[model samples]
Target: MAKHTTLKRGQLLKYIGKRWKNLNIISGNSFMKFLGYDGNGFADVWVEYQGRLLFLSIKEVELAV
Candidate 1:
């Protein structure tokens, strides 16, 4: 079973530089490094897929703890 939670700016900041499961459809179930906010309502993450590093801007996705 999977659990979900929404995090505010302060709470999310703590996870920076840590790995978390990205629930966004584009990178579903892939663990990505939290890079920090872009000051434009998007979360920046480093996703490794197919031997490539992808920089993605995500909005509606749950980060599992």
Candidate 2:
């Protein structure tokens, strides 16, 4: 089963200078700088990967490295 997480604002910030590959686990895909949590188990994350910008989810991601 895919692991899920409830990443807090502060915790999610840790991925700032990191790459999507650094994300231990991902449910959907991968960020930028401004992410908004809807308080309904979903979060919007922006990331710059492969010279492109990507929007990802929070609940569907896990960090275990």
Candidate 1 backbone collisions, by pair: none
Reference-based TM-score of each model: 0.30, 0.30
How badly does each model clash, as a count of residue pairs? 0, 4
> Can you write out model 1's per-residue Cα lDDT over 1-65, one digit (the tens) per residue?
11122334322211223354752323343444444444554444444444445465454333646
Off by over 4 Å in 2: 1-42, 63-65
- Model 1, runs deviating above 4 Å: 1-29, 43-53
List the global CA lDDT of all models: 0.39, 0.41
Q: Model 2, residue 1: what's the lDDT?
A: 9
